[model samples]
Target chain A: MSKDYNNFDYLSVSVKSDQLSRILQCYRVLGWTEVKTEDDKRYYDMSYVRLRRPHKIPNKDRLQYLQVRMESAINSLVEIVGRAHVKSTAVISVLVIIFLVCTGLAAWQFLSLNQAYSQVYGWICAVVACASALAACIAGACLRRRERRAAADKISARLKLMQSLIAEAKLLVPQPQNEEEERAGEVNNG
Target chain B: MDKSSRASHSLEDRSRRRRQRFTEDKLVKIRTEHSAGSFKTIFAALIILFQLGIIILLGTLPAFALWWYLLILAAISIITAFSVLSSHRAAQAKAVWVLFVLVFFFGGFIIYFMSNDKYMYARARRRHRAIFARSEKFLPEYAALNAAPDMKLTCSYLSRAGKFAAYNNTKLQYFPSGAQLFDDVIEKLKSARSFVFIEYYAVSDGVLLNRIWDILKQKAEEGVDVRLIYDDVGSRAFSRGMRKKMRDSGVQVKVFNRLISWFTFAMNYRDHRKIIVIDGCIAYTGGSNIADEYVNEKHMHGYWKDTGIRLEGEAVDAMTLFFLRQWEFITKKSFDYSPYFGHYQTLYSPYVVAPYVGGPEYELTICKSVFESVINSARQKLYIMTPYFIPDDSVVQSLINKALAGVDVRIILPSVPDKYYVYLVTRDNAEKLIKYGVKIYYLRDSFVHSKLVLTESCAVVGTVNFDMRSFYQQFENGILTDDKNVVAAVAADFERTFPDCDHPASAAKNGLARAVAIALLRFISPLM
Candidate 1:
């Protein structure tokens, strides 16, 4: 018969509100108790959830499993960070609208001057059109860059915490699935 | 039990019963609101019929004055729309929107001209967009604003000059605790000449509140036009006896958007502003409400930390305007409040002070814009202190971007949480921010309720918390200043109140609590 493992430890993580509930749900899905908070615990000391490893498994086994679990979670967050690089649809739409408006206005003016069709006026129209399009493109790029930076920053904050939590979990638990650990097994887990 | 112990227990019992009664009343009120909403179809039918009747009845009037009829109908509809928007009655809001949108669609130029005022805020925003286009150095364009010395100067100037008179002669004093704040408010009320206006989110039954009431009564007895407005929900703890005494002493008391007014539909919001404007020359605002704990007379969670500011210049005019505007709204009285502005000081100083208000009624959110601007503009450091740190996407984006851009961003939250669930949210944000380039600290052993944002050159402190409700829903007011002293004082407060932070390396106990909080927050995350 296997010896029962009773002396279980906890992993406490402070998460952003947006991600806290989801992380807690994740812990629950992993067969840990739902994150239950204390009445007096304020966030100044930093409170979100205390993720506990499920019991019955050997401590060594639990640690290895949790390490893998945490790594995957970290990877998902990293994926978000990777995908956070996005162009601003609003800026792009605005640019397209401006381009159309400027071109349409210039074309209409060109049509109105069809009979007069002076070479100087034609040259002036061409110059104005090129200048307007260039300016729009430049401004649009700047706006796109700014939006990208903001989105990156937001995603990175989430990514940073995920990395930190993984590190914290690593410090708390033992190494995962190494050849030495496989030989040691339940003895080391105890 | 001894007589005193029994008496205290009896008092507790009475308060408990009172609380239950209030809860029951609130339930009944909500049910009634829902019932009223069910009759919207009938109500709409009646309104349309009556409107048609009026058209037919007034059709006999001169053809030239036909526009006037539509104008009157439009005015009535606008009021109805505003009421529905403010109403706690949910169905009325949707109906009003539908009705108005329909009118705009089918109504010719006559109906359009008559009802266009319904979209005044939207139209005004569009117009102001063009105007603001000319002035690119707004509060939101921080990077562009900080790029050059000349641009930075222009930014400060523009910040001061937005939608209000830019006060140069203003002298602002910071009161770090409720002791100084309440004492100063009392002193200002005592010196009231023409009138005294007070508005607050919460007015609890306490020694500090009694002191405030006494001061208001004395001023009212001396013929000061004392007008007071308090939030109905927030001020529910106030004993009825105190209110009666105030009225008996001749102080005009009114509640802002009571439950009965919930039918006005905009009832989701409470007036979160804590403003005391005296004689139109002096004003006070901050996060502190009328309570003993606010001043640390009686501690609930821990030491209660708060902040307030006193203004004495053109900034007062802005506050006076805010008070008067709200007064007219709540009381439905159309008195010329111009007399209050008469007392504003004319002395010019170098301090550029801009005081502004934000609410759902405005097309542009002033508080959000200002915070975004300061966050965007932070070159060296960004210091923020708020109890609730639930920021919307834009704010989060700006904060993260600023920190990533090498700005030293620091935030302070309370170690002692007043609300556990909200505290959870705050922590969640804090952890993420800490992981980012931001350093998050807790104000050790105290609940810090000061809503402030301070940069190297600019500072803002007032009722606007860095939360969704304050930014998007509630009526909030604050003062923006490039004054060296105010900025320095704000920074000093931040330096003094850095709370003990729990490092991520530390083991957290109580999985149940975190799990429970997570579960509850998950269901209500969208609402939050």
Candidate 2:
């Protein structure tokens, strides 16, 4: 067989001696144990594992394809999560700005009251500052709670997508079969 | 089975259920919280806060040490607080007394209290009696055929004023929004004969305003006397260059009470009046401002609702006089009213329109008086539509009393509030009104900025809100019209808006959430 040929792996696997044994070995290597074979043809007809790629000679191209797909999926997931994080951070920044401005204004007013040196002025300034602070704290707390809830929602959605991907991966691999016939002689020996 | 695998399976299942439940609960909470009725709870809390502030101020001041000074201060404050608390004839008087006390202290208090008694007694004996004596002079004697007592009283008052008040012959048309009104105004400018006078609270330059400005320039070029008066604070966004451009085009513009220097807090009193009189024959008044959003042509706030009335009648003379007085006040030009009122004509019109003007500088709050008169005169039905509904105690009590007296009193407010605390206060007041058998409807589509009042046959439509600002402080105007068709038209619009709203049985229907809003708003109502 010409090793550099594009179709050489398919041709060599078909013509190899003990083709059925080679297919069974490929299934085992791929962690698929629910497939069966009759004569020289391999078949895996199960509801749990539908589509399968036939066994072939191992090569760099096939390995590279799988690796690229995994990388793309990981990259997309990271980008989506990153965008959500950015949005949350931006909202938090706005909240912080408002809080700082309110605090600064209140402090300025309070200090200005010191120039007045009147008890009534001081009390009024203190009341106003307290009110502003209370309002700011309430608003900040509400915003933070909303952000946390949004994060929890994002995480739950991501987890669900991950579970779906795992199920899809399981479907892509071939299964093994005919274990009962192979283990008959071993059971008698035990 | 492995312990870790089994535990992980159970954990995943539990988390999935929890997440689903959490989202569903959150949606329900959001929906309930978003309803318009939630504002009531917030307003109740604000009222409580206002009460607490009054108490604290009263208790903290050194009252015993300065008994006379403190007593006068305390009396004015208490009277003001009581006015805020009660629905009585004393509300306007009390508010005036509060301002009087602030200005002259003890001396002002005595002067005001004594003058107030004399003022009421004199007005009752002199004007009231003279109005009745001269009733047959101006009003058609047949006017009393189906007249209510309040109408009869108003007719008599107008009859006396008609003897001296200049009358003009003109046409009248009512527009439901600022957009349509402005379009008509631009057309009127094209045909302006002498002078064009404009006074408004807010006049922002935008697409619509720019178009109108072009017409105003053309009119000014044609030897038409053009004058514009806008409140300084209200038109804060307008540029100095824009003013110069208008002046360069031969148009004279005056800013009412320009905030030039510090210690001008007294200038806080705004000319909230909206009036446009063209060549002394045509005039316009209502709640519409010169903002693009008012026309639905701009996307500032979605669907702004407003109304304006076009007047060309004896009432137009009254409006012209009102504008000239303000023009004199702002420009210091001693205007001989002869030019404005000497050429008045009486146009026999299908609609009987009377324009009432009120301001803080006036000895009496005419707006509050008109409100009391209108509220007291309701027979079959009363309908109101306002953007803000934070009324002083008297107005609120009038509404409650009217509803309880077997009158069909309905109020329509915006479902989406423009101001948060004002919305809350409105909701709180609505809740109280609902308890007194008044039907409250929220306009679900747009913000209803039109300040209008409709009884069985007549209607009052203008820029005055039901709040203390409109009643006691700001300059406001309204047209009292005896037009059954206009009243019916407005009432029908209210009918179309009512069904889209959601009316809660009470603010307490949501229990704890309502309680929290009510508690919070009570401490902040006065500021609202």
Candidate 3:
């Protein structure tokens, strides 16, 4: 039933069910509390359960504002991810080229190795290959470390935003009223 | 109080404090006003005391003649002291004049008295003849443009030294800026064959100098006689280690008159000339120095505007002599002129380039005479650009009188000046000139440090400014050329520059401020 009603505007209006659910998922993935739905006619109607805007909101309209802010955050994260991917691919290609050059030179030297200079030439080729491989590995490790750091920062930012949204939802929730007192009196009489 | 009012008050207080600090930080004033009575009264009192002493001595001893001689000696000493104190050049010339006076007094008084008038007349006649000779040669160049009759007479008077400044086959190329001149200099240095001689006022260690040093070092290694002479005061920023490095690179270097004693401040006469001679074939002279700032690679005191002339002809011989004279004074070694003379072969060119050197030490003040000649020779149009516009009274009068006679006289100075007080004086002088219908243009982009003067056909571009310092103290070089092409080129550059500048007529100032500026400038113009 929730899935069928989950219609959201990632391009326009931000107060749709799927948008809130995605934010909620981001919060959960980032170890933040999930937002709770409120069920009180005085505070909100059934539409409000779908994360509709309030009629007369006090303070700032932070939910919609947070949606715009989160969109930009996501954009910047995607840009960083794109740049990292490009850099990784560039590094991999350079490493591949260097490895090919080193291996080709090594093979050529090995083939041309004569009776007197065969061992010396073979040693030089081996040393060159080892050095080239070491350099490639170091470059790959550095690129990976940078990519991991960016991912971690993006996740932490998303978690913080989700936590704030859950707090806002708690503020919007209605408290249980005098019906509980009637129930209590009935139990006492019994 | 409101916030703005309180802020303004605080700002005013800060400004007042800054003004006070500025006043306190000023160096002690070198010039002061003295009442005439102070010196006159002192002199009268001293004369009375001296007469009383003479009377007493005559009464005590029988040495009347000796007393009279002593009195005469005292009078001569007083005259010498006054001359030395009043005139800047008098101190140096005093010794020679004193001997003349003494010889006249001691021996053949009658002969001296009789010959003095004749001697003066003969000297005047000789000068007049020299003037006539120079005018006869160069007056035709300005004959058609001679609208002012008095200008011809002034020119004739000023061109007395033109006989010494004559040249044969020559070519002159005027560069509007130091950077352009440096480009030519690098090209010339690259082409130097036997020897490269450079004497500059200032040379600092920087990228431009380093590159020049590199080229010079290479040329030296290739058997070229590379020598350099720089003023000690000018090279004060260069470290000893830097000098050592230059010496290690095989370039012979000499510092001109290194100060050894405090009294040597009188050696304040600097070699302000910028001269470069390559193999006695090509030469450059004018205001540009060998520093990155001059080349505009580094901004020193803001954008640099300068002019230089490259010469290739008999004029190079004059430049060689100019450098050699200074070299002899410093190094006491006379270089053989024969080898250098061989390279001064005449080039068949239409341009008439006359390179001249000037200083107070010379037998004749060539720079002063040339400036006066050019100023007086200007008839239809007189265009001048100088960093410093402090002209002696004669030059100023000539310029003002020419302008009054309806000549299209224009002067260009720097809008953004390097020196504030000097610029103020320059503006003040410009205001006076403008009042006489002279057009004044303040170059807006940067400092216009080029000392350029253009007439209808001929032009003089050089290192010397129209200042007392350049005229009376510093050694300077310039090219006086009658090349129509070069003149037209300079005129075109001036035309392009004139519109972007502010004219004195358009300056925003009150009449009272203008009067005050003029008065202050006139009072201090002599010292400046």
Candidate 4:
């Protein structure tokens, strides 16, 4: 089925909103030109773009494989980022539940018992509940912020790997030195 | 436990394990691959015997006897005979079935009913009618197109029979061989922006299909709607893994009249039409299937000579409709037909292309009627090319009549046949026409798979073979046109092919045994 390339090979891929710019910039290194982009109605943050490149690019199979891996890595990064938010929400919810349980125990001791020891127990329980609430607020703000930073760093590492792949794939795309050579290259690579 | 008892148990376990291994290696694996069909056949036979056993049990009950069972069978046979008499099949076919019913009274009528049940095509017939009814609004009225008298007559007859009409803005390009067709098709497929609808009888995993599939996968990923309809029986060699791979790559695949369906046993009616419609603008249809032999990458029966035509412009709309109508029938799903109608304001051309479809569910054999009309109207020259020449009595008679009237009628057949028995019958049929001055030529060293007919006024091209199955038992599509350039191209191809053809004064006299075999084959050729 494989013959000398006589026409352009087209490709289209969908990227999340956060990764679209980086993905497009990296693909340009592999000789793909963006024809158009359309918003994906199924997902608010997802959009698809159409691209075409000369079918006879040097080492096309290798470049195409790399492009697929790049897309896969981006998808994995997005999933991990999504899971990070879910983890934060769960952590905060558990803390809030602990705070509510402590408050309930403290109120029971204060209302049902009259001895000093009971009152002291209730006060200690109330202080513990306050500390738990404080912990919940700290985790809700600082923990989530730190997790976001960690997710960002993970994405940055993946982007750097993609850039490295792009650097290697760009070498496989023909880079003609002269106008005549460029025209000839188009004929040879298309 | 005693030591002897434990030792005996271990010995038994080892022997049993060895026996299991032997069975797994020999019986299970071999039976699954080689004997699966026989197993199914045996199961079906058992079911039939069980039913008969119950009937016999009933016969043994009080006041029941063999005479009563015989009487019931006779009644059923009579009803089947009457239905055959009233059916819309050809006279010859009907006569054969009627005789069969009378001669083999026990099961012949039952077989006839099973094969030709009135309700077998109900689902397909209903869906086809609905799609065509909806399609009528999308196809513009072309009653004002300038057309020759004969072309106009033929086109109107086709339009009245189905949901196809003539268009003046369509451009036609004919490829004399499958290789050229594939090259053009691949280019057109690469440019598809919206959707690609492909319907073919045979699709094997070969070079040609792989090439087209590569583009199709890419286009599908690009969000283009890509759907394919292939006949399960025709594409028997298309492996399950290949089909799964296509689906995994996002190509929507549908099997037409699946050969192994429990719903109905009406497997005789096949989707034999080969069509490719891209974005509702460009279309290709012809004798070429998606296989290596089609494009000559593999020599099937000597050189595989096939032909196809590419249509660009409004005529493609009809091809798209043909694909969609079949898709809806097989999948039981429908979509809006408006988006697929090509609206190209093509430059003016003198040709009037009328794309039409034919299937078994229709009361009339549309392909046969149109071919007869064109043959009956030929004034000067008539040329026909078909891989198989086992047409029905009417078409053979028409060819004889035209030849007798001094029309230069020539039919080119394949010298190297892919099916030996069918080829013998084809030769016999050709010899029958030779006595009436119709010239029959066998393309030397090549199997001519092109289905085309040309008269002085118009030409017909597509997947309809000049055989009984195509005429009466398969879905077919073709383009009937009075296009001068297209007709000339086909005529030129025929003339070019004549040099490599063998024109015998008469086919070498067959041996007595072979002659008898051919005669027997011809009697049942309608079923072949």
Best by TM-score: 4
Question: Residue-wise lDDT of candidate 1 within B1-528, one digit each (tens)?
Answer: 899999999986665454321211010010101111224334544665576456545543543467776666556556655554564322422354546534642232233233332443354345434433433322222222113343244445445545444556778898766666877787677778888888998887765776677677778888989988998766766667888888899988899866442122234467899998888889999889987667654455455678899998756876877787777666755566546774877655577776777775455567777788777777899899898887776688788888988888888888778877888877776667665678777764467788989888888888998876787667888887777888888888777566234335222343887867765663443234
lDDT tens digits by residue: candidate 2, A1-190:
1222111111111112223453334333333232222221221210111112222323222222222233223334435455544554565566566556655665666667656555555565556556655655665567656766776687667556444544544454432346684355224422
**CA RMSD (A), model 4:** 27.8
Two-chain complex of model 1, DockQ on C-alpha atoms against the true structure: 0.01
After TM-score superposition, the amount by which residue B184's alpha carbon in candidate 3 deviates from its true location, in angstroms, is: 1.4
lDDT of 3 by residue, A50-155 (tens): 2222222232222323332343344344455556556766886787787777677677777885665766776676777777678778877888788778777876
lDDT tens string, model 4, B196-305?
Answer: 99999989875567788889989989999999999876786677788999899889999987665242446678899999988888889999999867765455465677
TM-score per candidate for chain A alone: 0.42, 0.38, 0.47, 0.68
Which stretches of candidate 2 lie above 4 Å from their native place?
Answer: A1-190, B1-149, B155-170, B342-346, B508-528
Q: How close is candidate 2 to the true structure, as a TM-score?
A: 0.55
Tell me the docking grade of candidate 1. Answer: incorrect
The whole-model lDDT of each prediction reads 0.63, 0.59, 0.61, 0.77
Alpha-carbon shift of residue B348 in model 1 (angstroms): 3.8
lDDT ranking of the models: 4, 1, 3, 2
TM-score of candidate 1 to 2 decimals: 0.53
